[model samples]
Target: MARPSEGAARGKPRKIVLVTGGGGGIGRAAAQALGTGGRHVVITDIDASAACETRRLVTASGGTADIVEANLEIAEETANVVEHAAAKGMLAGVVHCAAVFPQRTFARATITDFDQVMGLNFRAAFLLAKAAVPVMEVKGGALVLLTSGAVRLEGADTPFQRPFALYGASKAALDRWALGVAPELRDRGIALHTLTPGAFVETPGTRRIDRRAIPSLPIVPARQVGEAIAWLARNPRMSLAGRRLDATAFGHTWGPG
Candidate 1:
């Protein structure tokens, strides 16, 4: 593993935080935020090049990171990434940003589309949490789940919401799954939380969609989500545990430690 630039470890060893989808967008920002906090961030993405770019940014910012390429769709690949991170010194937390939002309407979506959606959004979170629980149980850590406000508004069939049947269902499952597991993990000192950035984030995927087709909801910068992930990892407020949090409500209040 390549060594990271210098920071204050305070005579203690640096903790390691694993970030999925660290290649770009919020994941990249989260990894950098962890690095700034003096943790060794393990940035993983299916795209090796994108993960590498995140590593580059982390290193340039005087933070440390290790880049690993793993396509989370494959169970073995997901295990590979988690196991590799577990082997690192300490498993501080996981920022799971590896998700895809396909634009298939309910009428047009296929079984295969549903499978891919559930597999990536919910199944991967389950598997990653399973693999990390044992290692994190040793020292107590955070597992951050990126959720959706869509779950909050799925009952409403407004124009900006109709196209979300598949994606919303998948994320809703994730939100519930994470909450279901949060209490169990809390017994072991790991805080599992489901959070939404509150609006449509302009990622490579969202950029392809017709902006006019999306809802005119409150928007937040990708980095805010990133900072929120880092804050969630570094903060130990159990009051926020097992809850669905909106970024606008909780994110801006915390600063990097």
Candidate 2:
């Protein structure tokens, strides 16, 4: 992987990174990681307070950042996010970390529940990418879609109420969407891909589960996934487009000492 310059850019300003779902867990980690990597990071979330806190964390890390409160499923908010990032000049990358994994089996899941899950997990991704594409066209940029390992390693015992079917279906659909959009984005000098960080994470998002039942899965640290994402954002590799990379593969390629 390439080593990014230590400080922000001079005249034209630093490359800007728009991270959706930046208020929590991997999103928060990725935002902070990118900020430290000399990029101007924008942290947006449905939660205003969380976004502000994340912005603080990024700034504390010696990187410039801003917080935008947005419900990504809404088109207007999505447009505003893109417009704000474009105003920054070179929107070099976007890390889409927003998702919903409500653990209800099909039998227990209502149509409303399924719609909400699909809306946030898959539909929102499509809309976010739509918003991001124009800014990325300024030169070229990277797109990173966050996915879970649960989709592939389905049998893992984590009593977090396996929304296994929903999670897996949404993920597979998201992957296909990335692949479909990659060629179009590539024509516009953009690179799009997905990253799957499969492991048990103890974030506010997952904390809703029973602690005792949280399986002792061989987990990759959240920070490692954040670092890999930061590296990938700046790396600009065409081979990554339309591909889904797991934590193990990414760790083997770019893990720290």
Candidate 3:
């Protein structure tokens, strides 16, 4: 398979990869990793300052990046981010990491809370895919949806406890949706897959939650998840479509040097 950067070597424009939630956490890490690997990374986040910081980090490390500030909960805004990336260069990959995890127990959660979580976490992925697939179809690419282990674990057993109910539901919905939609995208030469960190990651978002509720599982570094995403983006193959991959497993096996 031809890597994303090989185009640049062949005198073609550098391919672009879109990373949502790029202000921090796994999103920031993925942006840095992909950019360092020679892909022009387009980072979208609600926070302009934080996204700019990510852009700085990418450029400082001899990579290229652009920031598109967006509130992904809005369907139009979500699609607009993809449009912005496609305008930059060949839209080669997307890492959907934008999500909200409000620490509200199910009993105390309101319809508004549900809407907010599901809107950004689930709906944004749908909207981005709708907009990006056609642009990417001209040249095959990859779409990686970041999922959580909370989707499988019981809410009470999760690190976030009862508050994880809505978050888990949102991820479960995304996982099922991605699985159902992957086959058709694969036929279109677009590889779609869901990825998990495979363990708790102490990101800025997770830091806000109660640490006492967390279990004894090993903490996976954000960079591991980032590298796995970059790996998937660089190798968008038909054989890899529709699968659920673990970042830790990839890190141990075929990770970046």
Candidate 4:
């Protein structure tokens, strides 16, 4: 399969994009927006039903997308996703949005829980970058990873005093991962951007939490979070590589408000 750079031969609109965790929230939003932008988006998720539902939403909205079911927590599945996309020819973009946040206190948290969170959040970022570099190397492309505000506001002095050490630590790892990949991406004609959505969203998991316990709760809507992701995915600015965008900053730049 030819990479975008080799196939484009010149600057042109990107035609194909692959988004992990595209079945829900920001990933779905990015897929939908990119599809509306006239790109063929491939949507993959651990949840088969969610992937199908997202694909349905895209098709209904006059966008194009394909659903692929894969558990990103597994290394082999992660590699397969990239390989599958590469074989399709000229993969112009990749969005890594799949994540697992196992919130538990240090004493109560098992190594299995921590490892699972790390595996899904940080390890997947590393592996996906490795797998996609080849396809993106031939042509310049954008890479976006979803971090969390948990990392940024986890300190004791923050407004929210949640026991999210595990989640924060993993996200901090993601920050480092994005920075570590920036130079390599520069050499290979790719850009990496990290999007950090602050606070619990109205998603099913978050709705289970006490609304008051989450400070600055709903400061930014999930759809707005999705739009910020869409911007980072589509924007051609190289300066954004290795940089992290918080909810407020991204919202001010690309929100309905």
What are the lDDT scores of the predictions, listed in order? Answer: 0.79, 0.77, 0.87, 0.73
Q: Against the hidden true structure, what lDDT does model 4 obtain?
A: 0.73
List, residue by residue over 31-135, the lDDT tens digit for candidate 4.
Answer: 877766556678989898998988887777666677779988888988899888776656777888887665466678898988888888889888888888787
- Comparing 3 with 4 on TM-score, the higher-scoring candidate is 3
Q: Highest lDDT among the candidates is held by which one?
A: 3
Clashing pairs in 3: none
* Residue 129, candidate 4: alpha-carbon lDDT: 81
**Which runs in model 3 stand beyond 4 Å of their true positions?**
1-6, 153-160, 251-257
TM-score winner between candidates 1 and 4: 1
Worst 10 residues of 3 by lDDT: 1-10
Model 2 / residue 145 / CA error / Å: 0.3
Per-residue C-alpha lDDT of model 3 across residues 1-257, encoded as one tens digit per residue? 22345477788877999999999999999998998888989999999999999999988877888899999988889888999999887899988999998888757999999999999899999999999999998889999999988788655565456678888899999999999999999999899989989988888988777767555667999998998888898658567799888898884654444
Judging by TM-score, tell me the better candidate of 1 and 2. 1
TM-score of 3: 0.93
Q: Would you give me the overall lDDT of model 3?
A: 0.87
Per-residue CA lDDT of model 1 for 40-79, tens digit only, reads 8889988889888888888887788888888888899898
lDDT of 2 by residue, 1-257 (tens): 22232433344556888888899888998988998888888888999899899888888777778888888878888889878886875788888888887777768988887777778888888887788887677778888888877666555445543645787678778887888888888888788888888677667887675545555656667777787788777645576676778766674664343
Kindly report which residue stretches of model 1 are placed more than 4 angstroms away from their true locations once superposed.
1-11, 154-156, 251-257
| Number of backbone-clashing residue pairs for each candidate, in the order shown | 0, 0, 0, 1
